[model samples]
Target: MSKIVILGAGHAGGSAAGFLKQYGFEGEIVLAGAEQIPPYQRPPLSKAWLKGETNENALQLRSSEFYAENNIDLRLGIAATAIDRTAKMVAFDDGTVEPYDYLVIATGSRARKLPLPGGDDDLLLELRTIPDAERLKQALGGGKRLAVIGGGYVGLEAAASARALGAEAVVIERMDRVLQRVASSTLSEFFTRRHTREGVIIRTGAEVVAVSGHSVTFADGEVLEAHAVLVGIGATANDELALQCGLECAEGIVVDLDARTSDTAIFAIGDVTRRPLPHYDVMHRLESVPNALEQAKRVACAITGRPAPQDEVPWFWSDQYDCKLQIAGLPFGASAQVVRGDSDTGSFAVFHLKDDRIVCVEAVNAAHSFMFGKQAIAKSSRVDAATLADESIPIKETLL
Candidate 1:
């Protein structure tokens, strides 16, 4: 009987173990995780969880009984120390060694911390784990003030949650506009207006020189004092184990479409992999839950000798206050953009077209537009910009 050992009990690792069992793989499965708790959803850590709208039980991916009933060896609170590729064995920090026929690395990503002079890094709060969320939640309340360092999705979501909790929030972004790296200028402007309307102060073109205690100093000789400081800049892929084992790595651990790494017996998945996109020639490291689940399925299929799952267009979603932003596909090589609805009413979609084919769509509080764009991108359907812009015409009619 083949035995599979999975590292890092995040969404990808836990889902991979479950998929293998569901696909009738009679192998010995061992899922190891450094955290004491079972796999849980991370998306809500900055929003619903932080706002006290959801509890820890609701965030779990599966109950503890599910693992035992499935006959999976679920090892928690144990970290993998090393991997011996030749012998196909994984060493744990608890001084135990597990032999495996196939190994899966799903070690997700970690929050990136900003190093500042005279700044106590320990005082800077982050929302990557449950413990981190608890700390941040405790710091926010009726009269508390939160100073967010980054203006990305996580930072903005936390700000919105803080406002919902009757706390003051001020977002300081180093870029000229918020969400400049991931979103278009139109989106930045829309979110900026929305956040400002909610009484959240947004500082664009602002650079933080140093942070001391609850005080943040800007390069322009401006200082802002707050009750708490949050660093939500970004995340770095946890590829140290793969790198130590001599796997091919770029921005992340390099993997094929089947989630197989440079070594045929070893597979990598989730936020730790730099995988090839479906339609594009470039490789991307996606951090969304959908991406993690897709890769998990891919690894399971590959190991179980089943047919590969169909490629899916990458998508992401963010909830801020009463607004929902759903994005489909990457806007790479797009030449034109069309607005489907009115932005003033807070229900709109931006369609990005490349050579008349729909490449990407950013829908705000518009589910139909998001669904249409996702299907269109999957089918590589061509669309007319003029028809897409005309709200009078139906979205289906705009497709060519």
Candidate 2:
């Protein structure tokens, strides 16, 4: 019997394993992970779970019973230390090896840390894994003060959760505005104002020179003190395993449209892969659950002798306080943008257009616009800016 080994039992790896069985693959499947816990949802680590609204059982992607019933060998509490590509073997940290007819690398990214002068203190915390979230959750109790190092989604979400727990949050961003890397200035300004109104202090265009204890000093000699500091700068792809195995890597493991790595026997997906977005004519390392699920489906179909899954208009969402922000499509190179609804009313959608063609949509509390915008982008439908700007007209009618 053929054996398939999947490294990293996170969303991508775990989903791929289930998909393989769903697609009628009778071969042996091994799901290996470093964490002893079964695969669980990571997004909730910063939102509902952190706020104590959900329990550990609610975060699990699959229960232990499901894995055993499916005949998947669950190798937990150990990591793939090395990949001997030529030998078709994977060596683990616990002095064991597994041979495979095929390999799938789903090792996700790691939380990036601040490279400050005094950043080595144990007081600094990151919110990535279950353990990280548990520690941060403990620190969030009793109206503690939180000093966030970055103003991105992770940072902002944590700040929101901190505020919900009666803790004071102060977000220090090195850029001119929050969400600078991913969102538009209009959206950034809206979030900045919203966070500020919620009693979270936001410092923009400020550089951090050092971090001493819970005190953070800026380049201009400004100081911010708190009980605990959370670093949400970003994440670095865990591509060392791919690189060491002589696979092509740049920013992440470079995979083709089919999610195949440089070596034919290997495939990569999820946050660890720099995959080609054919529609956008660019490569993107998308870190959304939808993207991971889509790639997982594609790989499963390929291995099962089925046609590739149809491409989708990539989308993502974030929950901060009561606001629901949903983004559809890539917003790069947009020549113009149109705003519908009213930001003052906390319901609006920003439509990004390139040569009068809709490329992206950022919807805040506007589900109809997001649903319609996703369809428009997938179909490459044209839209009239005048009609899109008019909220009186239905979003479905805007598509040409």
Whole-model Cα lDDT per candidate? 0.92, 0.89
For model 1 the local lDDT of residue 188 reads 88
lDDT of 1: 0.92
lDDT of 2 by residue, 1-400 (tens): 7788999898998999889889988888999999888888888989987899887788888887988888899898999989999899999999999999889999999988678787777778998888888888888865689899999999999999999999999999999999999998889989998999999999998899999658899888978888889989989999999999899999999998778899888889899999988668889899989988888887888777788888877899999988999999988779999999999889999999997788999999999999888888888889999999998898778777
lDDT, candidate 1, 182-239, per-residue tens: 9888888999999999999999988899986487999888889999999888899999
Q: Name the candidate that leads on lDDT.
A: 1
Q: Model 1 Cα displacement at 310 (Å)?
A: 0.9
- Worst 10-residue stretch by lDDT in candidate 1? 113-122
Count of residue pairs whose backbone atoms collide, per candidate: 0, 0
Clashing residue pairs, candidate 2? none
Per-prediction TM-score to the true structure, in the order listed = 0.98, 0.98
